[model samples]
Target chain A: MPNPDAGGHWGEFGGRFVPEALIAALDELEAAHTAALADPAFMSELDALGREYGNLPSPLYLAERLSEEAGVEVWLKREDLNHTGAHKIRNVLGQALLTRRMGKTRIIAETGAGQHGVASATAAAYFGLECTVYMGEEDTRRQALNVARMRLLGAEVVPVTTGSRTLKDAMNEALREWVASVEHTHYLIGSVGGPHPFPMLVRDYCRGIGDEARAQFLERTGALPDVVAACVGGGSNAMGIFTAFLDDASVKLYGFEAGGDGYGTGRHAATITAGQIGVLHGARTFVLQDEDGQTIESHSISAGLDYPGVGPEHAHLAASGRAAYEPVDDAEAMAALEKLARTEGIICAIESAHGLAGALRLAKSLEPGARVLVNLSGRGDKDMGNVVEYFDFADRKGQQG
Target chain B: MRAEAAFATTRAEGRAALVGYLPAGFPTLADSIKAVDIMIDHGADLIELGLPYSDPVMDGPAIQRAADQALAAGFRTRQVFEVTEAVAGRVPILVMTYWNLVERYGVDRFARDFKAAGGAGLITPDLIPDEAGEWIAASDEHDLDRVFLVAPSSTEERIASTVAACRGFVYAQSVMGVTGARAATSAAAPELVRRTRAHTDLPVGVGLGVRSGDQAAEIAAYGDAVIVGSAIVNCYLDSEDVPAGHQRLAALTADLAAGVRR
Candidate 1:
């Protein structure tokens, strides 16, 4: 299979489709990216930052119980253990370093579940750059702890009230703020969406996870995993892992999208699974839009997975059949969340649980000796309350024999 | 004297032409159409009708606010074309818009409808020449001129490439940023104009900050066209009523057009 990034597009997707306000910024980023790719000094600086600040080379752990239960060997890429407790720190560190290199004084970001906000705040604190995070009012209320955490790190958290009062609205507010302050501020987008150079740049920064994981998996198993699975929201983690393995024909890539109830219910974030190819968030990608082309509301138990669009690379991967996408329902993901906690003693984010659930289903259909790798995208610490409340886990635990 | 005659005479003297920009339906759709007729009646050889977007990222606060107001007043893509259709090709009409709206409206349909509405061209401020392949075919199919912008920061290589891809004329941004009226034009604009002229035979029109008659004259002296956008947009904002707004825009357009020939 050809590398989708060959045409500077991810399979006829992911071009710089932005307003003129961002042209200069994107151009500057493109120049810096070109320089950084060629300059060993720049690479070394980013390497040092990743090592010291982002806690690079996150572990790849074999899930013994999960493997036994599924009758297949399962390995987990432990991005959940990274600093700030998620994979977001990887991109944030890279961008914050780039911001400093560009001599920008401030950073602005948008958050849905506040993982990106926390990561941005952490990076801002490390770099001593003033940071402002725009979060939808509903998200601020739901993720109050992360909001406090950002404020504690000296970053301002502004509640955005527009559109649907969610991640999309927050993103719009951040874009508006960036437009207003393009001279000295960098808008640190959280995921692998948005205009050119961003999707490519963010993917490059986060690809370290897959790079390290592939090597680690090969070292441990003496062969590549039959399938690599990760949950896809804006598809940052999935793209991170899938990109490195794109050229490996034998390795199957799977992206699990959130199916709130079911794809037929028209209330899921199963963009690649149910959406048609359309332009959204500055790139041509799969979007869950109505027949009239109006973007429809998407729902998920996890706030992070409630976006109506998927990253462009994911769309390309799915279209080319290099990657398979499946939607995981709320119940299935919650069940996987609990199962992982009890079996592996690792509490995974509800978003990541979708991957685990997908892996379990895939394991059932595969050969008994098949090996699979699931990207444990984040820890479930941020979602403990919701998990407990939604599943009645407290009562269920007491009722357990 | 007719505005077309003034422009023709200036072109015969090897002088640049003059283009004017007005937000489609600035004070009202009727007022905006009246302003367009007035500008063409006075001197605007080519007119850029800015399709107001909810988020006009490239525009400064004034233009952004004006766009927001226009959108609130039920301005839309179809309505802009409707206004163009009413004008009936008295002059070339260029639709200036952000790329998202263009993508959403379907580039092929937009190009077809725009041409069918008597529009001569389209100026996608955000669309880079390198990424314009898909829309280029659509524009060609519809026989609409695809105008590209060249900024001060554009490299020589990019300038040549963009100029080659562009039809009609190349919009030369006078400054680094977006559309807004400025107290004075950039000192580097004339040199930029000269540099752009060396690269392409296409007419180069300077935009982004031309607000006064003096600035228009200064730019027209060096370039193939001088574009004044925000100053004209401000004229409508300053008026208390639609009639007053149209009258103000007409008088301002005549004054600016006269300045180019002086």
Candidate 2:
């Protein structure tokens, strides 16, 4: 794993930029995480849970049709097939285990698309811990199905109406809730963002994606893929799949951020693409902000990627030139989603479609035999409503011949 | 006026200092200045002029509403200095803000500008001592007090380091929550204050609660200063007009000052 410094400084991008009240809780969490990693029992238990509950080693499949279209080999790391239909379960399971280790009885999570909230709720149900998921009021309206799923799994869904009423606001409310209830509650951050230990911890938990894929690809192809791509909303999935490739100098890493409309429209969540370095949520990262440092509201058709800030490690990677981040606008991402569904019989989330879109573009530029690996981070079951709206499925409902 | 002088004067009077807070441009810039004028006239010994930012995670609805209004009225980072300049000699004005604003404004530039405005110092709620190296250097270079906070949940080691880094009075979050006024004061404040007292001789200002005069009196009994934010902001939020807000703000400040002195 690419560990941050002792203070969780990922090249001056990540640190404890939170209220002093959260310091003790963060310290305790870090200690518990360190102890948990060192303990064989904890590691084995987590591994066992990952295998049994998450259905580990989600397939690595070669996409012949996609490859034919792009004139380059494309491999899909099928995180979409995991339990909860996403890669989110991996991080949730790890944090839930740690919460149990710390003797916490309740877990609170902030969700934008509700994928993480559903995964957290599922884990909370499994562990019999009280779960409360804070979601943006706008997101609740957008991802209503996931809201129902979380509630059905015994989690209270709180609609945060504060500040822009989106993913960032949801996180703000979750942090506020964690402050008052830190004694017995764990703030199960959904992404690899926030202050110390969180980006590192979440990345560590999700690294199984890259670990499994790298070994699987090596065994199948006898060489590493030329490129690795993933969507970068708070950057957990990207970090998850990018960690194993950091040492592989030959492998190019591409992070596709949500480009809501287009770059020039002033309506997008392409933080690294068009943003300044500032602090948001907790981590010092690339942020969409006004001239005075106020966080500017980011827009995206993908609710999950509609956040103003990218993860700190991503910022470091972008700065150090280890990884390249690009904007994949909504139309292009949705087109990629439709292409995958039509050609491969696989419908991936709009967030994951961004990675696919970027990968396809990269493949088109590469030689025919060069292979690109795309982390299909989640299935599109939760995004059907959006897909319908975006593709105008309503207009053709009865006209399908 | 500086923080030390404010505390020293309060100590000489054998009373806790009354620290009042308001977002610098809430309602409007002119009205905000008028409101501060009313507060200083009513008995506010120190002013925590809040710089309105978009994401204030540490604040609750009362402060959030006011901050939102301030931003809606187009409050920017430089206006914090404008407010500080207007209210500087009246009281020690410490800009209570999130760390990002100062960083976005350029740490050295922010310190230089704030000091140039005749402001006392800063009360950064989010910037802890561990990540405050640049800020510490800048504050010291500018001869400004850097106030960091200790919460009820803060460890003794954390408190020691936090207070050691603080040049102004140490800020103590009486509760383990965002800033708001509660019907009851923190049962945890007295103990947290006691722990913080063990580490630093600086006056510890307890915040995150204390809405009423009685609550201020309760905190003042043990803490060196009674920090009232949302209560005073609440008066403005609940008022029918700007003048009414000023009137209620003054009344609340007077009541809390009297309670702190008692």
Q: lDDT: which candidate is best? A: 2
Best prediction by DockQ: 2
What is each candidate's fraction of native interface contacts (fnat)?
Answer: 0.19, 0.89
Per-model TM-score (chain A alone)? 0.96, 0.98
Q: What is the TM-score of chain B alone in each candidate?
A: 0.93, 0.98
Docking class of 1: incorrect
lDDT of 2: 0.91
Task: Give candidate 2's error at residue A136 in angstroms.
Answer: 1.0
Residue pair clashes in candidate 1: none
lDDT of each: 0.82, 0.91
- Write model 1 residue lDDT over A1-401, tens digit each, in one string: 23345335876788776554466677888777667767888789888887877777899999898789989988999999888988888899888988888889999999999999999999999999999999999999999999999999999999975556788778767876775577799989899888877788888888988899999988988889899999999999998888779888999999999999877787899998985876666778888765424456789998888898888878888887889999999999999988889899999999999999999988989999799999999999999889879976676544773
TM-score between predicted and true chain B, model 2: 0.98
State the lDDT of candidate 2 residue by residue for A124-241, as single tens digits. 9999999999999988997788899999999999999988898899999999999999999999999999999899999989999999999999999999999999999899999999
The regions of model 2 sitting more than 4 angstroms off are: A395-401
TM-score on alpha carbons, each prediction: 0.82, 0.98
lDDT, residue B39, model 2: 84
Each candidate structure's count of clashing pairs: 0, 0
Q: What DockQ does each prediction reach against the true complex?
A: 0.20, 0.90
